[model samples]
Target: MKKILFAFALSCIGFISTNAQSLYNSNSYFGSSSSTSISSTNSSVRYQQGYTRKDGTYVNGHMKTRSNNTNHDNFSTIGNSNPYTGSTGSVAKDYSVGAYNYGSGKTIHTGSRGGQYYINGNGNKTYVPKRRTRY
Candidate 1:
């Protein structure tokens, strides 16, 4: 029993380590970084040498700055803002979503024994049963 348990544990650890290295260290999958280049002109978004300077987005067929890192206030330019209700102009912001971190959503996890686990609607994580084949 001890030997079987130890083998299982080692197998799980090996699997996880290999997966992590593949995901994070595999530059070949994402790109070599130096081989990739990007350029844009007459573009709503602007970047200089990979560093983004400004970003604009089109809404309702009109281009507007998506960034609020501007010099002046928009108190007078309310007509040119996003979700611009004509009364309150440009809405340049990264809005935070208001919701619970964990609710009725299905949560996935790895079982302690190295199998897959998923959360039940009642918020309890249950391990998935391993598949068995008939002899």
Candidate 2:
């Protein structure tokens, strides 16, 4: 009967959707798919949009921001050479920020500004400057 056939079709559709994986998890499909839609007439305003994975990783995109104000900021600091030693035969602070490890036999200092400083074999602190953008 028509009613039975309709019920079967609906069940099939539900099963398929339940078993199907999202496009991000699948590796075979490649094409443009709009994740979101916007309706605005202002062309001068910049819109920032991007996608992140389940692990907080972003892919296949760029971000843009528009601001009407600009200001210059200065940061200065001074510190002493109170080097913290890591435990022997173990890696300290290996993965996270402000981590130290003695398993590698090195003292690493990570900066929020994105470059890493490490102590060399001779116990010398090395400072590596990050690359600057050209505007």
Candidate 3:
């Protein structure tokens, strides 16, 4: 009886571990950055060069300065100073929104994991993935 219980416990542990690994991979696959290149436009660039961490993990995305824009809807503008960051802006920004572009939204928020997302009309967070730019 002891041997049978031990075997069952080990099998259960192995099965649980396998499921955990699959779940981690599915969610963290994009966390492993593989981008390469620098953007030269004032417009928000999708992917920048990624760097490997001390733990051999790759972190993607580069720091970008706040863009200058005059769109009243944009919080970065002068009179429309960002309520979150309290930063003012100018009169030159792209005011277009595509199916996947979250920057064009009235507000862009950072996720708990440092991802970019926007609040949809339904009051749900819509995470925007970093798109790969064609070289």
| lDDT score at residue 46, model 3, on the 0-100 scale | 20
Per-model lDDT: 0.37, 0.35, 0.45
Ranking by TM-score: 3, 1, 2
Ranking by lDDT: 3, 1, 2
Off by over 4 Å in 2: 22-135
The superposed Cα distance between candidate 3 and the true structure at residue 105, in angstroms, equals 2.6
Provide backbone clash counts, one per model: 2, 5, 2
Q: What is the C-alpha lDDT profile of model 1 across 1-135, one tens digit per residue?
A: 997996686566556644653664466766787455321111122111223323454334322333343312332232232222334533221111211122225444545654444677666665432222124
Each model's TM-score, in the order given? 0.22, 0.18, 0.22
Question: Where is model 1 more than 4 Å wrong at Cα?
Answer: 28-135
Q: Locate the minimum summed-lDDT window of 10 residues in model 1.
A: 39-48
Residue-by-residue lDDT tens digits, candidate 2, 1-135:
997996686566445433442432344443457444321111122223567866699865321223322101101101111111111221122233323222244444656755456677666656432222225
RMSD of each: 25.8, 21.7, 20.5
